[model samples]
Target: MTSEGTFCLVLHSHLPWLPHHGSWPVGEEWLYQAWAHSYLPVVELLRRFAGEGRRDVLTLGVTPVLAAQLDDPYSLRTFHEWLGHWQLRALHASTLWRGQPVLRELGAAEHRAALHATEDLETQWRHGFSPILRSLVDAATIELIGGPLTHPFQPLLDERIRAFALRSGLDDTGLRIGHRPAGIWAPECGYAPGMEDGYAAAGVERFLVDGPSLRGDTSAARTVGSSDVVCFGRDLEVTYRVWSPKAGYPGHANYRDFHTWAHEVGMKPSRVTGHQVAPPDKAPYEPALAADTLRLHVKDFVDTVVTRLRRLRARNGKEALVVAAYDTELFGHWWHEGPAWLDGILRALPEAGVRVTTLRGALEAGHLGPPVDLPASSWGSGKDWRVWDGEQVADMVEDNAALQRRLLAVRPGPLRDPVLDLAVNEAMLALSSDWAFMVTKDSAADYARRRARVHTERFGAVLRGERPLPLEDRVFGQLDARLL
Candidate 1:
């Protein structure tokens, strides 16, 4: 390698519990879309790279909730059904776009893409995602990282529940992947003053945070709160070049526009022409052009990493680390060209003198620095907790706090109560960071509000010695508190 400096790409993959929920544009559909698009393609690409002997391509953090759903029998069966429906939708689009030449071309491309995805899912992902992910981890092509159960914003959670959630999440990952993870994503990169104690107890060695959380000194990994667990900060200057909400590589003209949809067929038919262009006025998506654009982005990112690492090395007078972190859903799901871009960058970086490693790999490579008294922080809006505990969702914050207290106060008698376990899980689900994020974004505000309320209600009911309402027809009976 031309430089000893390392570049770690941390992909945080997470989604709240969504099975048995609504579909289309949200809920289980969200999981299925990400699965078929992001998860399947990204995994396949990683496997392909691994076959060619690539190692430490990236660190992948798959939250426990998402893992549970992906590994669940129902999710596997239902996802296949969803993929079949998606292929049919493309066929319908082909028919619907019969006359217009451009539309017909777009329909053909989408149809072929859907067919390819379905084939991949049937052949590789037929069983569950764990096997596929486990294979990658085994090959050392990627490091698998775990997160809290349900992906809660950990800063606001009670210490005991927080500790339990983190430990339980790692345990769940161990059960699925055949070994416990030594690191966690820390649920939204949210960190509190004393979180390192829990993380230390949970056996986490390192985690990623936003650059601002490190006070803009993200050139090296730093330990937090006297714990040996190192915290790496995301190089926003590198990550945002591909995926910022306002402008990023995804908004480039050649790529598919995520918003404009062929409603009848449930396909995106337009390219991102210009910011002001209405959906109807947007030009048809051309995969060939998008492929070329993907290459350009891949080269740009590789160059950017090379430049950043060189500068950091010079400034620090030693080998430095630059961590670029992002949501794994960005690939294939959010950005149609994301997986290709990832493939290109990984392939291009090594050839360009930038060594790619996981966060753990960086630490192992001796990128560690001194321990710092880290503040209560998160990677959320304003580099603080506003997106979750701000004025807009104050009620939710209170509700979560109250539920945590109630949950911790519950006595399970002498035996492990399955009902208590179920209720506690529900309460934790309600505290997921996704709901507050959704509410703050106003995209799925109502659903987020309802979900939070439902979980709290379930916890309350269970605590009051009453049975929570069943999903379908089954009824839960009251639990006896005096059984001890």
Candidate 2:
């Protein structure tokens, strides 16, 4: 597998801050899913790679909200408890899976895998956060990216609301890791015409967009229309090869169905009948066929990435970069075997003579040929803002407009500290997608509302002149307790 130039893999990891306001089968659960699936597993894979003495240079955008949760003593504690819960569930599942003869041996294997994963979590937590990710960014193994404080859909929100979110995020990340970031994920990959000025203000020199955002400007990095900040878009072909709406390699029939979940609570033993059933209604846990299927899926996905990258290599005589970007949740969270696929592919790329690199590493190598005026665009649906703020999300727009109006009135001044804090806090909550998602069930609406309410209340208390917001520690403490 030959790569044209410096190939970069960027995984944007962000979910609206969902700590309290537990609303259900979806709410705080999303956080748990990320912890159980994506965060912990990916950390394991990367750490394992690091321990092997191979420097796996990859770029992953972890938003400030997520990073805060990660570094927070509260969040880490909750993460530990979640891991323990997963262990118990796995044990529960094993009991059910062993009942089936054809899957008994497979169930045993899955049980062993689960146990191994649980044991690995402790070591990963010990490996520490600043080193694995922060150190990588410091040493330039990874290009770190931040987003609005709570991850707001820019362009839709007022300039100050958006500005505050951006500032808080950049500021917080710096506080956490002791380094300033140069790029942001732009929540939902959302962007506006003049957002770059704020990026410039926040010390962010770059932001990501879709292929169309670059609009025929095939260069390493292109400047936004009349703006100094650089913008880069995802190459749909390379990205979709691994993740797409209908045809991504992850949907292979052989692999486990992410939505199938647990019917009767089994450790292993899937009940998929080819690809005819909806994910929610699928059968019990099945690992026998799932493992073989995952193996093949990983092989095919690696081949697809290799083939397309090689073709790009030959087509573009000059060294060109083939970047594969995706949501971090897709791995471990959406596709159960995704981390395995990633681990396999990351290893395979170098073997095929493709130099593994991160966004920062690649950009540092050289500029994109020349600069073209990039369009005002995003990586959303059809490379637009429909995914986050489309025809379907109008109500959420109205809700935020009022919230922003209220916040703009408060203006962090000399009056009351609690009043100002509440306004700022709620303003931050207003930018989150939880409420909007709750309004639209296309995703986890219930969980969305719960999360939205969480930040809103936190902001309200401070605004009510509670100055210090006594409940802050209580709320955060519960999160800490859950971890233990």
Candidate 3:
């Protein structure tokens, strides 16, 4: 328990603007998976921590695109229906497995989880964006940082797009959360040499970058172009300690396989046929066995945290911060047992006496290391921005870039006050991650095309000044003239 040991479990929550039609590959389903694993469960975990009166700050990032969905009446209604459906499915699961002792117990747990998930969704929506989470930010239990208006790829984007989106994001977030965010998620954690100037204009004090950006420099923050905006790297070693791309604990052999698929039988549901990754063994998600698996991973993670932090106490003698940031979608969506794993990790981190802090909280205390410049980088694969505008998605990126430039020329300059709202809309429309992800995954080509067309067209409309309504110009126009 050294004074220097501290950690920030920073979870970045975002989905590339999946509105009414974004339900298939890159839309509503994405929300359901994230809602199931990351948001609801994370909320419960933080709620428990708050109830325990824990003083630690756990950072939760809610991107503006995701915020719009949460605030949308249609999305909320859809989510309610999704919740109700899952509840019934859980009941079906319980009844189907009633004869098997172990499976029955697991089904019962799912049923309870289903019920809790619904409550958590409503609770979060009831406040516009998880009042508990918002409260945590205000109380500093969780540092609430936001991303761009629609979570765009910044470096490759036109600077105008970067300015409009980030500024609008700050404004919307302040409106929703009731306070200004101290840190920006930087949309995919993307950063470039002079991008900080845009952040600086938006009154952003700090942001998240990646390791290569730091280039082993270990500098916590550095200024750009006379702007005091500081950027922090993802602290890779500590982050990989929990969820590495290929070697993290979640991928262990004994963990409930995430690749398994199931089919509901006619009179009797068939057992999980098998796992695709681990092929030949498909036992589905057995909570009884999975609990042991979760415990193992949690202990290993906490042990690593303790060992690393202890070494930090010896090396730096300053408040040592291990910034372990991750995609929130990883918790429940990608990893089947992720929610349980997160619950285990959160509970374990505090009990082991490790200090948990957020990006904002960590900055408040200051860094001892000298400020070294970070390279242009992101939290994407290889700490590069390839996923956003790689060769596969280059055409899409170029199209958006050209559109962005035209929009700026026709509508507003970055410094102009009149063009602020239009800039906001086009900025958001350009940032939707659909096309890039579609190009990357290769399975959602049509879905991506549809989304890009939708937003790109929306941008064109704004540029032409054909749209007069605010919410509609931004979010397909809501009833009663409200901006969801």
Pick by lDDT: which candidate is best? 1
Q: What is the lDDT of residue 102 in candidate 3?
A: 60
- What is the per-residue lDDT of model 2 for residues 10-74, given as tens digits with 9 covering 90 to 100? 88887665555452465466776776778878877766666666553687788876765565565
Question: How close is every model to the real structure, measured as TM-score?
Answer: 0.95, 0.86, 0.86
The model with the greater lDDT, 1 or 3, is 1
RMSD of 3: 4.3
Q: What TM-score does candidate 2 get on C-alpha atoms? A: 0.86
lDDT of each: 0.82, 0.65, 0.67
* Preferred candidate (TM-score higher): 1 or 2: 1
- Model 3 accuracy (lDDT, Cα): 0.67
Model 2: how far is 90 from its true place, Å?
2.5
Which regions of candidate 3 are displaced past 4 Å?
97-101, 122-124, 217-227, 265-280, 313-319, 350-353, 412-427, 461-473, 476-484
**How displaced is residue 67 in candidate 3, in Å?**
1.1
Candidate 3 structure quality by residue, lDDT tens digits, 1-484 = 5453667777888876565664654568778767766777777667776777765557788887777766777777778887787777777777887887766666677678778878867665564564555777655567788866777788877776567667767777777768777677877677788777777777888777776677753434455445677767677777786677666766655555554433451111222333244444444455556567678888888888778777766676554667778888888666666767777777778788876667666666675355555567777776777888788887888888777666556533345343345544644665576568666767578777767776677656655677554553355221111121
Q: After superposition, how far is residue 158 of candidate 3 from its true place, in Å?
A: 2.4
Candidate 1 per-residue C-alpha lDDT over 359-398 given as tens digits, one digit per residue, 9 for 90 to 100 = 7788888888888777777887788889998988888888
Residue pairs with clashing backbones, model 3: 22-27, 22-28, 23-28, 265-269, 274-282, 472-477
Give the C-alpha miss distance for residue 5 in model 1, angstroms.
2.0
Q: Write the candidate numbers in order of decreasing TM-score.
A: 1, 3, 2
